[model samples]
Target: MVGHTLELRGSPFLQEIIREVPGGERIVHCLQCGTCGGSCPNGADMEYTPRTILAMITANQRDKVLKANTMWFCVSCYSCVSRCPQKIPITDIMYGLKRISIREKAYQETDAPALAKTFTDLLDKYGRSFELGLASRYYLFNRPLAMLKMGPMGLSMFTRGRMSLTPTRIRNVDQLQAIIRKARELGGVS
Candidate 1:
């Protein structure tokens, strides 16, 4: 136990995670038990399971951990949190990893970041997500050729009334914006 503690103390990556993420201090208690990974619904799809990511963090594999597609694959269902014996906030840590990845531009290969930015931007602007607008903006900005190919599917959805061209603002958009702004401030998200 003493040796493990010394190793944890020496890991700058682990310290960074503990400092930046809420509930991250519990990471040191992880037993390498695979419960968190087993509980994840999308576990198979992730490049690295939650357990492996935690191991990577402890091992100070900063580049591998930050650049992995594991965090982006997390659906934030909190299943891992519910099942973890150490009470680690696995989902929350995934979110923290995502923020760090974005800030560092470590996710250059995936379009998930661009899609997320477009979705959040629309949410901030309209207080609700417009599916058509979201898809249009995401594809137009990130994958223009893909947008051309999606024309038929988009038209089909529009014809089926599954999508609307115009965004619908919430009745109290100002209130929503105020809450969002305060949350950003508190989270230091800018």
Candidate 2:
């Protein structure tokens, strides 16, 4: 991806992220071979591809890296992680960047953050995805018109039994909550 060059500087941000993410220290081993970029499904839409993000981290471009939308664009598919010659946990690193961005409020107003927050809230509450609830809450704030546009499709899905009207609760919901709590405590994805 063509983008602005970032100047190298001291960044406690990068060091903190590396410490938080498992295998994040491997970022220094990136070959800049574009393997992660090539493997990313949404690479074309990112301001910086995974490879470039690694380069930015190495260069300690904390402000630019945190403000960029590349981390939010990641779908967490792990294609880059599996394809990386250096075996960096690119997906986990993306999550770490996301957490930092949210914490710092460095990101621009975008639907991706809202969507992630909605999904996480639903998961925390129900121990499973509540699709209808997610869509309602997400579109309610992000794009009210999209809700109207999706009405027909949502109706069709419900009629066709493709969508459930009621959410299904897991039997071991307490166990799920405990796991989620532990992960949060360990600085895993929230």
Candidate 3:
């Protein structure tokens, strides 16, 4: 039988994760119990499970961990975080990994990153997501032909008042932008 390992001594990747995520320091307490991975709704879709990702981090497999689709597949449902015996913030670690991957361009040819960027941009601009704008911009740039196929659905949604043609900014958009700016500054993200 194996016990929990505490080998966070020399891994720069682990340290970076600790710094990047809000509660990532708790990751060292992980028991590798596979609870987090098993609790994940999208674990099967990921190239690596949350448990394997943590092991990779301890092993300092920086390139493989960052390039894997594990982080991108996380839906931030917090199922893993809620179930972990060590109380590790697995979902937040996934977010930290995503930030690092985007910063390092460690991801391969996946539409997740591009879609995330578009969603964030819209959120930052309008203080909320503009679904129509998001879908239009994403499909227009990512899959041009797909946009044509979506036109009818988009029109139907707009006609039914389920979607809006233009974005409606929040009353205090400046405040929201300020908050976002401060977050970026503190995160050391550009």
Candidate 4:
């Protein structure tokens, strides 16, 4: 039975989104190196360590791989990215997998997806990210406690210009919209 091992072995979209990083091949080249496992900050809690993720990806068991807890636990710390002997941008791969999973509407993250949408909308509105608007929407729509937690150290960060209460918009907003339009078509942004 094929079960869910992989989807017929010729997943073109997987190849499309997966960049040809110089040394990124041979996620199979792993030496059973505990390096990634040992280096991961959240490895202990993961059902699959970074090493296991690599194996699963190479096996073409990506759906199973994406559903695992390790991907969810990743903080995108780039710790594994720097240390890999294969020099694979494993973090980028994780992000790519998350993107596909998200685009398919397969699962959900309590706040990250909506917040990501808001951030993407902000990017489409301007050329870059705006933390203030993102945080406001995140707090208002999802977690009110985040506002209370930040309330203590919030003002100091604001005055230092580390955070802005107002969103800074770029002069050419239309150009940004065009970019988002293209990205949505190319399967990068949803």
Q: Give the candidate number with the greatest lDDT.
A: 1
lDDT by residue for model 2 over 1-190, one digit each (tens)?
2232222223565577767787776776678999999999999999999889888887778899999989888999999998888899999999988878988888885688788899989888888999998999999989998899999999999999988777778889899999888887886431
**Higher-TM-score candidate of 1 and 3:** 3
Candidates' RMSD to native:
2.8, 5.3, 3.2, 5.3
TM-score of each: 0.83, 0.83, 0.88, 0.75
Q: Which ranges of candidate 3 are over 4 A from the true structure? A: 1-7, 188-190
lDDT digits (tens) for residues 1-190 of candidate 3: 2244445736888888877877777777778899988988899998999999998987789999999999988999999888898898888888889888998999887788889999999999998899989998999899899888988998898899999878989999999999988987886532
Clashing pairs in 2: none
Candidates 2 and 4 compared: the better one by lDDT is 2
Higher-ranked by TM-score: 2 or 4:
2
Q: Give per-candidate clash totals.
A: 0, 0, 0, 0
Candidate 4, residues 128-183, lDDT tens digits: the string is 79888888877888889788888767778888878877778789988878876786
TM-score-sorted candidate list, best first: 3, 2, 1, 4
Question: Model 1: residues >4 Å from true position, as ranges?
Answer: 1-10, 186-190
lDDT of 1 by residue, 141-172 (tens): 88999988999998898899988878999989
- In model 1, residue pairs whose N, Cα or C atoms come closer than 3 Å (at least 3 residues apart or on different chains), thus clashing, are none
| The 10-residue segment with the lowest total lDDT in model 2 | 1-10
Provide the lowest-lDDT 10-residue window in model 4: 1-10
lDDT of 3 at 47: 93
